[model samples]
Target: MTRSMCRTRRAGKSAGVVAAALMALAACSSSSDSSSHRATGSAPELSGTVTVFAAASLKESFTALGREFQRQHPGTKVTFSFNGSDSLAAGINAGAPADVFAAASPKTMAVVTDKKSTAGTPATFVRNQLEIATVPGNPHKLSALKDLTASGLKVVLCDRTVPCGAAAEKALAAGKVRLTPVSYEQDVKGALAKVELKEADAALVYKTDVRSAHGKVEGVEFPESARAVNDYPIALLKNAPNAAAAKAFIALVRSAEGQKVLTGAGFLKP
Candidate 1:
């Protein structure tokens, strides 16, 4: 009887151990399945066209970046709508189908945020300072902010809605100089274009913009420019149909590769 009982007890112990092992194995299997499901469910594959609404000042650099992005992502076209920051913000607020927005100023970006048009918080990607872009050789001999007020110089400035115009206003306010422009251009490019086309003797534009213009014009540095530095902010649109692509593009813009290209085109990293 004792021997029979001992065998029975040992068998029972073995069964319990086996049962525990089976339970543990089942738990591990359940955990692994959940983990796999989560891993598979988290991130979707990214593709498609990314529509970017950018400030006019970003035209040159962003165009180059768009080309490079297309090279990296075959069949992925980047459609850009370049204009004044306010205009872009207004467009986004009006239900435009833009995937991303890159503005020349935080203040302008506020318009989007206020309207809840942004998918995420805006990130400052670059900083730009104003320079006096003038006709070749600066025939007016313009050198300072006050020089525009001199007799017989045709000056152009960005519209009050744009970042460059805001900077120009702040710079003028800081320097206590009043300048009446021949035209209040609708955008920064328009302001610079006036000088480039010889329609205006000079225009206030970002140094980066002037640099990108190459031989089209010459730039003059002024003291008050330091007081009004414009920060470039970029954000994904709230209604972005291609949110993943928009995020990827924003990452690329903030990445070292993007910075290299932007800096090369005269943008300063923020």
Candidate 2:
């Protein structure tokens, strides 16, 4: 090998090494940029109003969860319509504009699902039992389901169409106690209000409602309630305008943090 040839070969080897290094550096930079782009676009930004039609029984806990969801997602808003599950289901079936539906019972939930108004199968998230909501301090000393049967006890009850009313009837039947109510309110909250306002001596309501009352009424638990526990189911509406936010809200309700708020509000885990 001549000296000149040796020098040329050495120079060629140096160029090859430099070229490889440059290619490696370019590849690294390209990979970094691609990763940065993916990182920025990985999560789609969630923004919109999520309208929820929920049973009155879920008002307290769901409201808290809604606030938490909005906080976690700054650009999103949660609006809730709290009412009798039956009524809410009817509205949904009638093409009401709602993102989510949380019913007090599977029966009520089916009213929408059977109509094919829901996006998917409903999920039971919690259970609730009946309690006799009496005036603060239990002036009548109503201890059991039978006590509500006393003559002249101005007792109120939810109408038979609503979940609370249906549960109340189940509990009543379980106790084998026959009683006529002064009035059958359209919803549990209405029945509970009768007790809170001292209009009714006692009303068959949910344990959660009595607790949410914050001393406005007293709660009486009966063994019959165990047989009449109601299951709460939630689902996304097929016509949900804000599907993404609605799904997120449902996820939150089924999440540990959501369950914590619900359990803290006297609801039983599913």
Candidate 3:
């Protein structure tokens, strides 16, 4: 063949190969686009806010759980109001709007259920026992529930209506130890604060609270605590503004991952 004709044929072959490569690239791009669209539509889209009224003791674990819930359900937010269980129940009964309620004790949870503030049966997620929270380094060397009775020692207790208070009362009575506290706080965290701030030598609180406090306070476990183990109950509020998100939150709390977080924070599995 002539040299020019040979060169022309080679150029045509290269052009044809380039055209085939472009068509293959276009086909793959079209397939990927369709798959991306289907995946986007199939994935559940959750948005809005879920308000949770939880006990003071659950602040740490529930807060972590809420964050993980938000991670799994992007565009959703979890807002929590942590307080004394009895106080939260009263607020719910008084028509405070909340998507979920988690109480430190079943007795306190009953307050909300009795008022018909819950949609279904409350599930026990975890349990806690009373422990003495003392100032870091145990300045008073408070050993047991009875140690709070030492004269000149300023002790704080939870109010009779609070879950921690109720448990503390039961444990004290079981031990037959009677001592007047200098102050009666409304929530477990308040009682812990007294010890943390050095306002009180010791306070009866949940184990989880002491754990949450890190180095601010130290926990001293007592055998009498066995007499009043508190069960933490959670339920979906009636007519929750974000019912779907609330349900998802509760499911996460009951799921293995949630239990892992709770147990890591020193909560006993229910």
- Listing every candidate in turn, what is its Cα RMSD in Å to the true structure after a full C-alpha superposition? 19.5, 19.0, 17.2
Per-residue lDDT of candidate 2, residues 65-110 (tens digit): 7877776666899999999998998888877899999999999899
Q: State the local distance difference test value for candidate 3.
A: 0.81
The CA lDDT of each predicted structure is 0.81, 0.82, 0.81
Deviating ranges (above 4 Å) for candidate 1 = 1-45
Candidate with best lDDT: 2
After superposition, the stretches of candidate 3 with alpha carbons farther than 4 Å from their true spots are 1-44
Q: Compute the lDDT of residue 124 as modeled in candidate 1.
A: 96
Question: Where does candidate 1 have its weakest 10-residue lDDT segment?
Answer: 6-15
Please identify which of the two predictions, 1 or 2, would achieve the higher TM-score against the true structure. Answer: 2
In terms of TM-score, which candidate is strongest? 2
Give the Cα-based TM-score of candidate 2 against the true structure: 0.85
Model 1's TM-score against the true structure: 0.82
- Whose lDDT is higher: candidate 1's or candidate 2's? 2
* Alpha-carbon lDDT of model 1: 0.81
